[model samples]
Structure formats: structure tokens, C-alpha cells
Target: MTLLLIAATVAVCLMMLMAWLPEFRAEGALLRRWSKGGGENRCSETVQNVVDGFIGNFSAAHNLSETETARIREMKTRPGMMPVTLLLHPQLVTREKGRFGRGRNLTAVFVATGVSALIMPPLAGMTMHTMSLWLLPFLNTSVFFAGLQLLRCAYSDLGLLNMLVTGKPD
Candidate 1:
């Protein structure tokens, strides 16, 4: 049973690491593009679709006027590498004066996971046993990877905002 728990922890760590790699890769490309100089909209159609969807959602959520939402679609970074709406429409980045901020997603995830770590063992009916000990390692590993992923997402979101504001990804 202990060995099984160990294996599960290793497997989850590997899986989570794999899941994060693509985000980092894409982020690197975004950064390189911004560092060089923003240019024509290089983002894929899928990304454009995602931005459009966000515009729709943001308009609905904020009860934006049709003219206001239309302006969001026309907004683009100075380099024109991607749509500025990608940053402005997201609640995580939106701020007063038409700017962006890190917002609370990353911090909230960290705090929630920390609280859950303290709360889960007791809820699982585990006491001070060898299994419980193994559980701690697994839980720690899970929290570490989960936090890492959330951090990566926040980093990417902020990277986009930086690119929009400074017209540079770096």
C-alpha cells in the first residue's frame, strides 16, 4: 500500500509536469515575439476565437454597450501581434483606467490549497499511521504541482498583459 501511494505520487507529478510544458512553450514564443517587436496578428485562429469568446463573455458579464464591446474587438497591441482584448476582457487582468493587474487568481489558489492540505487528512479519517505519513508526501507533491500550474497560468496571463501594455513580452 505504501509503495502504491509512492507510485501514485510520482505518476501525478509526472502528469502535471507534462501538462505544464506546453503552456511554457507557448509563453516563450509569445515572449520572443514581443521582445523582437510586435507585428501583424500572428496568433492562430483558435487563439483569435478564444479572444472573441472572451469579448462576448465580458460584454455579457459587464453589461457593456454594443459600441463599447465593439471597440474591444478593434483594440490591438501596438505591435499588432495579438488582440488587446485578450488582456482587457479577462477579469483576472482588467483594472481601472483600461489597464491590467495580476488580480487574485494565483494567490487565491495558493491559499485554498494550503487550507485544503490542512483540512483533508482529518476529513479522510486518517490518523497517525504509516499510511498517513505517506499521505503527507502525496499531498505535498499534489499541492506543489497544482500551485506550480496555477503560477504558470498567472505568469502567462500577466505576460500577455505586459506585452499589451509595454508592447514587449520581456
Candidate 2:
């Protein structure tokens, strides 16, 4: 049972890593550039340019209508919004008509992350007797926070899903 719990935890972590790897890489590059003395204005401009290119490519590939394109552009301007989140917004909005492919796969990944986050704490607690008292709390805490982050991503995806389905913000 303990082995199973550890395996499940590892699997969930791996799934998250695969889903977020692209965003992680982008952030890492941005961080490196900033650390190398890229001024705030320059960094912000670079981010905007990159986001614009992504939005343009995504819009073209998805054949987004003008209104959908405008919506996505507006979404990008929102404070603290991540460009990656917009990647699926158009597809999700269009999905109300029963057409979309890749977004479903991404959504599945996020849903799995959320389910794992809900299950991990109890699973970790069940295996607590096997670890050092100090180590158990540390491991549990790390897993809890990681789960929370994964849940946040899943929650955001759910909001996107809700927006398209119910025609309202979540």
C-alpha cells in the first residue's frame, strides 16, 4: 500500500511536469534574460512580443473568428494572466458547438492533477508510519503545496471550461 501511494504520487508529479514543461521553459528563459541585465521595459516588451506571436499563430491555426480573436486579445491584457492559458480559451469557447480536440487532452491532464491533489494528503497520511517523524511532515507539506498548485491550474482550466459551456465567466 505504501509502495502504491509512492507510485501514485510519482505518477501525478510526472503528469504535471509534462503538462507544464513548456511554460516552465518559457519562464526559465525569461528569468535568465532578466538576470543578465535585461531592463524591466525590455523584458516586458520581449514577453509581449512572444505572446503576440503565440496568439497570432494560435489564432491562425485555429481559424478563430474576429470576435474570438478579440476576446483572446482582451484576455491577454488582464493583469497576471499567463499567455499559455489563452492557448486553449478559443478552442474551449468554440467547443460549445461540439468541436475541439487538443484542448480535451489538456483538460484531461488538468483534471487528473486536481483529482490527485484531492487524494494525495490522505494517501500520504496513511503511509506516515513508514517515514521519520520529521521527514513525514516535510514530505506531506511539500506534497500538499504541490497539490494546491496543481489544483489551481485545474481550477483555472475549469473556469475556462465553464465560460464556454455556460456563456459566463467562472
Candidate 3:
């Protein structure tokens, strides 16, 4: 059972890391473009292609209108606007109202995941006094990855809130 838990935790962490690689690559490309003096076409073709693909996927997922999609595509070309465009995406995407709106749902997830990640270790330590030492390390590693995930979500949420309030991405 302990080995199974460790394997599952490692698998999940690997999957999460894989999911974030594209965003990191895009950000790196953007930074490199900016450092080169922010020309209209400073970004490499690879970066442009990646951004276009991301925009297309986002538009299709959200079922955005033709004009809205065009606006976002235009936003991609402007220097420093790509981050702002992405930060404002949750507002652009439509979803049916549930028990909570999108922002609240994100807040709830942030709070729940945070509490679980923080509380798990100590509680487990106290309850599972006989737990193997190897299992404890795996548990801690999972919590650490969960914390990283929480930070990523928090950054996105904060960026969205900043854009909504100040009309700028931080």
C-alpha cells in the first residue's frame, strides 16, 4: 500500500510538471523578445506559432465570437500585451453559473488545497506513528509539490484580480 501511494504521488507530480512546461516556454520566449528591445516582430517564429496555437485553443474552448477572437489575436502582436491577454482570459471564458462563480470557485480551490497540504503532514505524523520512514518522505514530497501547484494557481488568480481591478497585469 505504501509503495502504491509513493508511485501515485510521483506520477502526479510528473504530470503536473509536464503540464506547466509550455507556459514556461512561452514566458521565456516573451522575456527574450522583450530583452531584445520589444520590436513588433522581435519574437521568434516558434514563439509566434506557439502563441497562435494557444490563442486558437483558448478561443475554441471558450466559444468566443469572431470579433473577440480577432481582438485577442491582435493583442498577441502588441509588445507586453500577451500576459495581460492571458491574465484576463477567465473573464472572457463563459461558463454556466453554479453554486459559485469562476473567481469564487478558484478561491475555494485555493483555500481547500492549501489547508489540505498544510494540515496533512502533521496530522499523518500524529496518527500514523507506525508509518514507515520511507513513506513519510514520499508524503512530504507530495505536499511540497501540492504547495507549488497552489502557488501557481495563486499567481494566476492574483494576476486576474489585478487586471480586473487596475486594468493592467502585474
lDDT of 1 at 24: 55
Off by over 4 Å in 2: 27-45, 74-84, 88-94, 98-103, 114-123, 132-170
lDDT of 2 by residue, 1-170 (tens): 66665666666666555655544666445533443342333347776666566567667866767766566556544424443443523332234352333365456565655656665666657656554433433444454465456446545654653454345664
User: Would you give me the overall lDDT of model 3?
Assistant: 0.49
Candidate 3 regions exceeding 4 Å error are 1-41, 78-112, 123-131, 134-170
Candidate closest to the true structure, highest lDDT: 2
Q: Report clash pairs, candidate 1.
A: none
The global Cα lDDT (0 to 1) of model 2 is 0.52
Write the residue-wise lDDT of candidate 3 on 85-147 in tens digits: 333234322334211124543454344445446544654664466655445445545645654
Query: Model 1 lDDT vs. the true structure?
Result: 0.50
* Candidate 1 per-residue C-alpha lDDT over 108-170 given as tens digits, one digit per residue, 9 for 90 to 100: 545545654554454344425445454645565475657655555556655655554445555
- Residue 110 lDDT (model 1): 51
- Stronger candidate by lDDT (1 vs 3): 1
Best by TM-score: 2
Ranking by lDDT: 2, 1, 3
TM-score versus the correct structure, for each prediction: 0.41, 0.55, 0.48
Better candidate by TM-score, 1 or 2: 2
